[model samples]
Target: MDLSDTQHRLLAYLREHIARHGYPPSQMEIARAFGFRQNRSARHHLEVLAQAGLIELATGRARGIRLTGPGTAGTPGDGLLQVPLLGRVAAGQPIGSDPEVRRELTLDPSLFRLRPDYLLEVEGDSMILDAILPGDLIGVHRTPQARHGQTVVARIEGELTVKRLDTGGAEGNGGHLRLLPRNPAYAPIEIDARIVDFAIEGLFAGLVRPG
Candidate 1:
């Protein structure tokens, strides 16, 4: 379809939302995201998309939108990646990692700067300053090592947490390693490998915000 720039953006957002959340965004959510004064504006855009055969909408449903055009089925041939949603991890203090696979999210590779091996639901606001907020689904690239200043998914004493890696500490000399938080309200986590088990599970790839 010959979509306008705003229509194209709205379509992309709809695809991303459905891929990330397993459902389309509500009209109110769309209105807020697009800065529309009323939900009617969002509805108008959706109706245009629906008329173009890009999406199918159901009446009497809060999140009734569905993708229907070419490359919208989220298949491998459509250039979509199926990344597993592997439970929750803490963005505040270290929390027990839930290794269970909740569901698979079909996402566009362009959403992340780096390709992610899996997705994790964050559960704290410690990384808010870094734009990783509570309930955000963060993309994690599986890796045993990460460079300094890079955000990493680390395990300390079997619990997982997301933080910026600071190897500048005595860690280079086999001492304590630091997991720095973006928010100053929370203190950085110091890992004493001699006392607690510490390992870098993966590097932070990118994230998909909840709609």
Candidate 2:
């Protein structure tokens, strides 16, 4: 139960995947989820988790990973809800309505300023200045609208990405709204509603960092 941060995440992901889809992710899927280039990386992690009593891997089966029911910690309570952990939101499109739920996170709604509809495992450092890191979990409140300057999950063209909402271009830039990144290392993304598909997926509600 004394899991490393990565191991803890793996366990959480295993539980979440099963909860959402009634199946655990394959080793390859886990590797891909965590950005590991090789299946061996995930295999090693799974072995570690198994030895720790967090999961049981059935031999000879493809998707045989099973949760052993709260090993390192006690059972979760009613105060927690399993929030879907979404995969990468590409910059060119909105995420599909049935986009795969990579995992589920058990969280308390009261921990955040607003209740979150889901949790997104961010993949890039575009929002580093805002303390949103590559592996950090950002809680999202499902909504189609956001106030100017608020952080939001949006889809442009067909891809999805997170950025600060900027609705100030009613006259200039051909009324093209912009998705601004907090870090100066990245430039703002301009969205011309006339030329590309665009929609707001959610508003930033809270954040959970990996420990």
Candidate 3:
């Protein structure tokens, strides 16, 4: 659906909220912000925004709205977020008791920070065409709110997947996240909430290839 002027205002408001708090505004919050008398009235706008492909339900909880768009990556900005690639968390093999931090990678800090806790690695040929060859380094945001079109490190059924994220907002609650691959040989992975702990390591904002 084409966004009306009011919807554009609402979407801009929502984007500000996300930039301020790293999350979307709630129905009540949006209504309060926009001065909507009824909750459903606010809901109507949010639903419209979702239909327009602006946000999605990143979390199962209500108001799990997340911005779906291109992140501030490779924007000629110098602000880089550096995280350690601790070590490889095997996707095709068993994970040991713990892994080691082998190297450090620089990325957009606005996306996420790499602490002693979280780590990620590229696996499989799904995103090969995207230059995410198996064993390549992928920067992770360690966030659950990965917007659509952003590349994410997803855990599905206890297995890890790196693909372009496609969200369906609240309507896709029945299970609506598709892990799209850059390579057409592999089919996109649809995530159902029934299996693993689905989490976004971070938006695949950047990558580093060794010479």
Tens-digit lDDT track of model 3 for 35-88: 889878977877787777776543344455655544433224443333566554
Maximum-lDDT candidate = 1
Descending-lDDT candidate ranking: 1, 2, 3
Residue 204, candidate 3: C-alpha displacement in angstroms: 0.9
Which segments of candidate 2 are over 4 A away from where they belong?
Answer: 1-78, 90-98, 169-174
Candidate 2 residue lDDT tens string, 21-130: 43467888899999999998998999998898767777765666766655422234433445777666532223443368876655544446778888776777788787
Alpha-carbon TM-score of each model against the true structure: 0.67, 0.58, 0.47
Per-model clash counts, in order, read 0, 8, 8
The best candidate in terms of TM-score: 1
Distance from true position, residue 177, model 1, in Å? 1.1
Write one digit per residue (lDDT tens) for candidate 1, span 93-141: 8999899998666566666778899999999899999999998889999
Question: Model 1 lDDT vs. the true structure?
Answer: 0.84
Of the pair 2 and 3, which is ahead by TM-score?
2
Q: Considering lDDT, which of the candidate structures 1 and 2 is the better prediction for this target?
A: 1
Q: What are the lDDT scores of the predictions, listed in order? A: 0.84, 0.72, 0.58
How far in Å is the alpha carbon of 176 misplaced in model 3? 2.5
Task: Give the lowest summed-lDDT range of ten residues in model 2.
Answer: 71-80
Comparing 1 and 2 by TM-score, which wins? 1
